[model samples]
Target: MSLLNEKVISSASEQTQAVLSFVRAWLRGEETFEIHTSGSTGAPKRIWLTRSQMEASAQATAAALGLEVGMNALVCLPVQYIAGRMMLVRGLVLGLNLIVVEPSSDPLAALPADLSVDFVSFVPLQMKTLLDVALVADDDQLSSEARARALAYRRRLEAMRAILVGGGPISPGLEAQIRQIAAPAYHTYGMTETATHVALRRLNGPQASDRFVPLPGVETGVDERGCLHVRGTMTGGALLQTNDLVALQPDGSFIWVGRWDNVINSGGVKVHVEQVEATIETLAAEQPELGLARRRFFIAGLPDERLGQRVVLVVEGAPLAEDQEAQLLRALIRALPRHHAPRHIQYIDRFAETPTGKIERSSTLKLLE
Candidate 1:
C-alpha cells in the first residue's frame, strides 16, 4: 500500500519501498528500534530508542513548529537516519501527508512543478545547493528548461511553511542568502540520541537568533566541563550528557561554542576549532574573492615539538596559491589571536564523510598521511 495516498500500488522504487516498510512497521506497533549515530565526533554506534521516545520527539516538534494534521511534510533525507525517520513518524503520528523522495544534493529538483510542502528538513549543504539553484542569475548561461526548473524550485521553496536545516553548521555566506528568501527557515541542533533536533534557531525573518531555544518539555543545562546536558520527555526523563561546549543563557536558550573533543591546545592556549572555522566563514562571506567559503574545510590540531599541539587549517581540494595563502593568513591573524591563527594550511582531494554527509574530521585528517 502506498503510504502517500493510502492507495495500494503494484510497484515501488527501492527508496519508496524503504519508507513504506518503516511506516508499516510503525503502524503495526513496533516498540523499540536501533539507530546509528552520525560519527561526526567518533565512530558511529547503534543506540536503541523506544517508540514512546520517538512519539514524544515528534509531538514536541509539531507543537514547537505549530505542525498540524493534514499538512504536507516532505521526507527527503535518508530514512535510515534519525532525522529522516522522525519525518515519517511525524506524518504517521500527526496525520500529515508524506511526500517521500530519495535523498540527493537537490531533493526539490525531483518534486513536481506545482508541488508545495508545508514542512521539510535539510542538511546545510542541501539548503545551500537549493539556494544556489533558486538564485541563479538570469545572465548566467543555462538552457530555457533549466531556468524554468529553477523558477519552479524557487516557488516551491517560497511556499513552504517551515524549513529545518540540520545535520551540520550553516556557513555565514549561506545564512546571508537564507535571509533573502521568504520561507521561514530554522537551524536545528540535536543528535541521534535525541531522535533529531531538540532545539531550533530561526535563520530568516525578524525572529532570527544565534541561540537555540529548546522545544516544549525539553530542559537544557551545562555540566562542570561547560558541555551541554539535555533532559526531557524525549530522553525518557534521563539526562543525556554531550561533549558539545556551550554557553547556557539565563533564559534557558543557549549558544553553541564547539565540540569539547575538537578543542586545540597550542602553546598552552586553548582555541575552539569551530570558532576559528566560524571566523574563516565570516571572512569568506565578507570577501568572496578569497574563495575559502566555496570549499569544504576544517581546523585541526597537530603534534608540535614546542607547542605540544599546533592549530592547522585543513581544506578539501587543491591548495591555495602562495599569495592567496599569505593573504588568508594575514586575515586570520588580524581576526584571531596570534596562537589561534593556523600555523599551516593543508589540502586533500576529498574529505571523508559519514553516511549522513557530515565531515569526518579525524578520518579526513588521517588522509593527509
Candidate 2:
C-alpha cells in the first residue's frame, strides 16, 4: 500500500473508513468504492465509490485520452477533495509517475524543473492565472525567461494525453483565451461525491465548446425541473440528484444553466444571480487594463420590513455613495429587468473562499450580520 498522507485519510468522520475500504478493495482487485461530496450543494457527505469503478473510469479516460504510462501527472488540488485525491489514484492505477504539490496559484514554482510532467488538472481560477499571465504579463512573447517557462509548460502539456479542468465555471472569455493558446484543456463536471468528474467536455482544439460526454457505463437524465440526475455503478449505482439546472439537448448532451439554489427572490420576482453576475462581468471585461483583478459580487434578498424581500448587491470594495449607487443601478437596469435591479448596494472588503477558491456565500453573508 502506498503511504497515504494523514490529510488524505481524514476529513469528516466517515472519510477515514471510506478511504480504508477503498484501499482494501483496491488491493483485493475489487475495483469500485464510495467517496464524498464537495458540499457545494448542501453539506459534505459520504457516498459510495469503488476502485474498480475508478479503474473503469481510468481505462475509459486512457482510451479517450491516449495517456501513456510512466508520464508524469501533477496533482495540485488537495487530496481531501475527490478531484485532487483521484489524480493520485489515476496516476498510480495507470502507472504514471505522480508528482504531488500543495494547491496554490503557482503550482509549477513548487515543482522541480528536471522532472517532466505529462498531465495536470486545475480549476478555472488557476488556469486563468497561468494562461492569463503567459499572455499579458510580458511585452515580448519570447523573452529569455518567459520563453523558458512557456516552453516548460508547453512541453508538459503536449506530452500529456489530457488535462482535466473543473471545480468552477469556465467563463467564455477564459475559454477563448485557452483556445487561442491551443491548451489541451477539458472541462470536467462531477461532484466530490461522484469521485471527481463523471463527464468531460473538451474546451480546446477543433472540438471547442463540445457537449459533455458521460464516462463509460454512466447514464444521465434531467429531472422535471431540468436539474441533472446521474446514476452509475461507478458511484455504486447511487442515483445522484444535483441542484445544477441543465438544458437537455436532443443530441444527448446537456448544457448547464445556473444552479437552482442560485435563484434570488426579490419582492415578487425571482432572479438568477448567475445571469446578473455574468452581465456585470461582461461589462467589466470590456475594459482591458484591470491587471490581476478579483471581482466578486452577488445578489441577495435582504429581509425587508414591508416587502417580503429586498434586492441587495453585495460587491467587494469600498461602499459607494447613494447617488453613485443610484447611477450605477440605473445603468444596470438598462441591461437587466426593473425588478431585477438592486435596491441596496453593500460593499464588503473581501470574501471568504473555500480551499478550492470558491466564494463561501454563507460566510460572505455572515459579514453583514
Candidate 3:
C-alpha cells in the first residue's frame, strides 16, 4: 500500500464533505438528486431520483428490518453509491442516530469504545472483516487496553439489532462463519434502480433461505427471458426490469441466476456462468486436497471462430502447471455439464475493480492477452 499523504487525506476529506453536503441539501427540501449507475451490465449513466422515492424506500426498509426512530445506525459504505446513500436516507427519514465513518475493510476499527449502534450496513468485504474480528482478534496485535477495545468492538457488532450486507455475493465459507453469529445478518438483493434492497435473505439462522423473499408490498415476476421484474412503493409502483435471470417461485420468491448477458453459448449449448461458478465453489469446499479453496477463479467467455463463444476459466495467481490445469479441467467436466466446461485457462496477477469495488470482469479478462 502507498503512503497516505497530505493530498490524499485532503481528497478523502473533500469526498466526505460532499456526502454531508448531499444530506444537508436533501434535508433542506431538495426534491431531486442525480447519481450514476454501477454499469456492471452496460455503460454507466446518470439518473435522477425524487426525494419522495428515497423516503418511500427508507420507510419500506425500516419496516422490513423493524428499525425505529432514535436508534443508532452506522453508515460504512462509500457515500457515492446507492447502498451508502440509502443509509443516509434511512437516517433522515427515520431519525436514526447515524454514525458516519471512513469506509474501510473494518469501518468500526477506529471508533471509540463506548459506541453502541442499533443497526448497521456492510458489503461482503466489510462483513468478512467484522466476522474475522469477532471470530479471532488475537492479543498479539496489541496491548491489553487495545485488546479490550477490539473485544468491545466485537461485542458491539454481535449485539446489533439488525445487520445488512449488500453490493456483492457472500460466499459459502463466509455464510458458514455468519451462521455462528447471534445477531440477524441479511444478504440483500437490490440495485441502484430500486434505491436499495427489495428482498432479503437471512445469512444465518433457522429461517435462512436460498430464495430471496421480497419485502412487504413488493411484487415479483419474471419476463419472457426469465429476467426479474419488481413493483413496489420504493419504485413508485412502476415495474422495474432487471438484467438478472431468476427462477421465480409461485410464492413470490426467486433464485438468482447469472446476468442475462453473461450466458455463454458454445456450439449451440448455453451455459450459465453462475451455475458453473457455484459448482466449482462446492467442489472446492468438498475436496480440500484439490487446493482450489485458496485459489480465486471466475468463468467467462471469449469469441471463437468455430464455437461462436468458448468458455474460459480465468484464475488469479501464477500460471499453473499444464498437468494440473488438465486435471482441474477434467474435474470440472465431471462436476459441471459438458457444455459448461472451460475451453481455455487464463491466469492473472489480480482482478481489476470499478470505483465502487465490483470486479471488472470483462476488462480483467483482457489482461490475459
Candidate 4:
C-alpha cells in the first residue's frame, strides 16, 4: 500500500470547521501544529507552525490571485504533505467547496462522480496518470461508455480553474501531451520548507514558459553558484536556500537547470545526470537501439578506490548482452565527455521509488550497498 493508505487523517472537529480555525485560535490564538516534513529530501522532522503564519501564507496566495471566498477546488493529493494540507486550509479559509477524496495512484479518477473540481494540485506522477487515464480508449474502435468516460474526464479537466503541479519534474514529452489536451497545468517550484510553491511556471497554452514567475511578495534571486533562493510570506521564518541550480532571467523570473547535488563528478569532470538522462531518453525516442529497457535508470558514483568515484549507469531491466551494453556506452561517449560517461553499466528489473512516486536515488544507491 502507498503511504496515503498507511496513514489516515481523521475528520476535523466543529472548532476546526473554519478554514483558518486552528490558525485563528492559535493567533487569538488557539493552537499550533507540529508540521512534519515529507522526508523525501532528507530526514523528516516536526516543525512548530503558528496559526498566524499559516493564515499569512494562505492570505498571501488569496491576495495574489484575488480569490474570493466560496470558489470550488479539489484536494486530491495526500494530506500529509504541506501542499495537500494547505489545500484544505485554503478551502476552509476561502470558503471553497473543496472536494476531498482518498489519495489514489490516479487522483483525478478517484474524485466523487457527482461533483466537479474547479482548482486542483498534483504531483508530476498524478498529472501523468491523469493524462493517461483520461484518454483511456476502450477496445473495439470506441465503445460508447469508454467514449463517455473519456469525454467526462476531459470536460472535468476543462472546467478546472487552475492546476498546480509539483513534487517532481514533468518530462518534456508529458508536458507536450498536457498542452495538446489543453490541461491548465502549472509546474510549481517549492517544497515543504516553503509552505508550498513560491513560484509557478505555466506548462500549457500560449502562456507556457519554462521560467518560473514569483508569486506575490516572493523575491527571486540567485546565489554566487546561481542557485535559487526564496524569501517571502510562506517562508515561515528562515530564508530557503535551495540546491536547485537555476538561471535568473532579467525579467525577474528563473529557469531551473538541475540540482547542484545531482551534478556527477567523475575524474574531475562535472556532469549533470538529468542532462545525460534527457539526451539518452531523446535518443531512445529517436533511435530505439539504445532504449532504456524500463522506466528507471541512474548515474551513480561507486567507490572506485582508485578514482574515488566512477560514473556508473544502473538501468532497471533484464540484463543486456555485453555487446549491447558496449554499444550504449560508445553512443554515450560520443554524446558526453569520457569522464562523464558511465564506467560500468548495471541492470535491474525495477527501481525503488518514493511514496510520492519520485525516483528515489538514495534508496536506489542503497541497493548496491
- Top of the candidates by TM-score: 1
Q: What is the C-alpha lDDT profile of model 4 across 166-223, one tens digit per residue? A: 8877776667668866656788888777777788898888888989988877887888
* Candidate 2 lDDT over residue span 145-260, tens digit each: 77777766555555556678898877667777778655467999887666777788989888866588877777889888888988876566878898888877775577777788
TM-score of each: 0.94, 0.82, 0.89, 0.83
lDDT values, one for every candidate: 0.86, 0.70, 0.81, 0.70
- Please provide, for model 3 over 196-308, each residue's C-alpha lDDT reduced to its tens digit, 9 standing for 90 to 100: 89999887788887889898889999899999999988887899998899999999999888789889999999999878887888887877655577878888988899999
Model 1 C-alpha lDDT versus the unseen true structure:
0.86
TM-score of candidate 3 against the unseen true structure: 0.89
Best by lDDT: 1
* Clashing residue pairs for model 2: 31-51, 31-52, 32-50, 32-51, 32-52, 33-49, 33-50, 34-48, 34-49
Over 4 Å off, model 1: 5-12, 137-147
In model 3, where do residues sit more than 4 Å from their true spots?
1-12, 137-153, 285-295
Task: Show model 2 residue runs off by greater than 4 Å.
Answer: 1-36, 141-159, 288-293, 304-307, 320-328
Error of 1 at 309 (Å): 1.0
TM-score of 2: 0.82
Task: Tell me the number of clashing residue pairs for each predicted model.
Answer: 0, 9, 0, 9
Please give the lDDT score at residue 70 for candidate 4.
62
